[model samples]
Target: MARRPKLFEAAPGSPAETRCQLCERAVRHTSRHHLVPREEGGRYGPTVDLCQPCHSSVHLLLTNKELARRYHTVEDLQRAEELQKYLHWIRRSRVERITNRRRRR
Candidate 1:
């Protein structure tokens, strides 16, 4: 028999959070992230589902040029030295959503 999806893994009508490709956490909310930036001619490129904090961290740490040139794949992003510290901390935390934050203009 096929394995059943866990509680948050299954969303009836809406797309569930599933697993974050980066931190490997199952968040209640997730966003699709393009490996190659959409603005950098990757509008139709590959994407991975990332949790809110992981997704936000990616943008906060890297620029579109860096993403397009270096960290365009999940494996590459995971090995990024800049994200090591944040990843280590987030992996041990239970908080799904990062509370305090600022929006980039």
Candidate 2:
């Protein structure tokens, strides 16, 4: 029998070990998303745990231009109370979107 490497060990120093900063979901097989734009001095921080669908939805619904203008990195977001508020807002919005779609029978 072969032993699989722990996810954290495979991706050493990854932020996925932490629950999604937005929805509080445990991150698994997650991709790294810069809360702040790297080009704008954004660095890594708490990340959202989005299953592939959720991750795609976020990018589709929220434009890159908007993200670039709003948050360049997690560090930048942590500095602003308003952005923090929006983090929760975005989480709720995602839940609502998912729920509403499920209920549209």
Candidate 3:
């Protein structure tokens, strides 16, 4: 049988832990999300920490071009209709990590 991915313990207030910018959930691990696509010339630009699921959802819902042109800031990303729905759903869960199923074009 395949093993499950490990979940970080739900220890509130750990110094190393941070909140997901999108879902606003406190999680142990966070991946940096480039405000603009690196290929679109934001290699040295701003970034925000997001949980894996939230980060993956952003890429899944919006194209790199869209991210580079429109959703380049956390405030902009938060206002996106596509992401607003996802944020609402994910915020209800206490689990720090959730599985993301990528959609094929």
Candidate 4:
């Protein structure tokens, strides 16, 4: 068995600083998003580290197919007009955490 490298580890003498790749904000909490989902045959691709609000917003706003097909890169996500507006609001709001409400089916 192989071990996965730590993605959030800081240098020996420094504290770990996690930042949202899309919103470009320094966050104390973050979630890792695979650019292409593992279920979508993205076994080994890029991962975007995002704050909770950004991470939740991605899933809330886009489907997995969309994530895999279109918003699969940091640049792709940042350039989205819809997300740009959302990012602006979140930045002004200065929220550090977000809780996703259960979707009604």
lDDT of 4 by residue, 29-79 (tens): 778889988888777888978888898888778777888989889899888
Candidate 1 is scored at a TM of 0.78
> Which has the better lDDT: candidate 1, or candidate 2?
1
State the lDDT of candidate 3 residue by residue for 76-105, as single tens digits.
Answer: 999999888888888887666556457787
lDDT of 4 at 45: 87
- lDDT by residue (tens digit), candidate 2, 18-83: 444434444454556765445544555435444443444445445555567765544443444544
Point out where model 4 deviates above 4 Å: 1-16
- Range of the 10 consecutive residues with the lowest summed lDDT in candidate 4: 4-13
What's the lDDT of the predicted structure labeled candidate 2? 0.47
Which of candidates 1 and 3 is the stronger one according to lDDT? 3
**What is candidate 4's CA lDDT for residue 71?**
80
Candidate number achieving the greatest lDDT relative to the actual structure: 3
| lDDT of candidates 1 onward, in order | 0.83, 0.47, 0.86, 0.76
TM-scores for all candidates?
Answer: 0.78, 0.38, 0.84, 0.76
Best by TM-score: 3
Q: Report the candidate with higher lDDT, 3 versus 4.
A: 3
Query: Candidate 2 — which pairs collide?
Result: 36-72, 36-73, 37-72, 37-73
- Once fitted onto the true fold, the runs of candidate 3 whose alpha carbons sit more than 4 angstroms away are 1-11
Residue 10, candidate 2: C-alpha displacement in angstroms: 18
Model 3 worst lDDT run, 10 consecutive residues? 93-102
**What number of backbone clashes does candidate 2 have, counting pairs of residues 3 or more apart or in separate chains?**
4
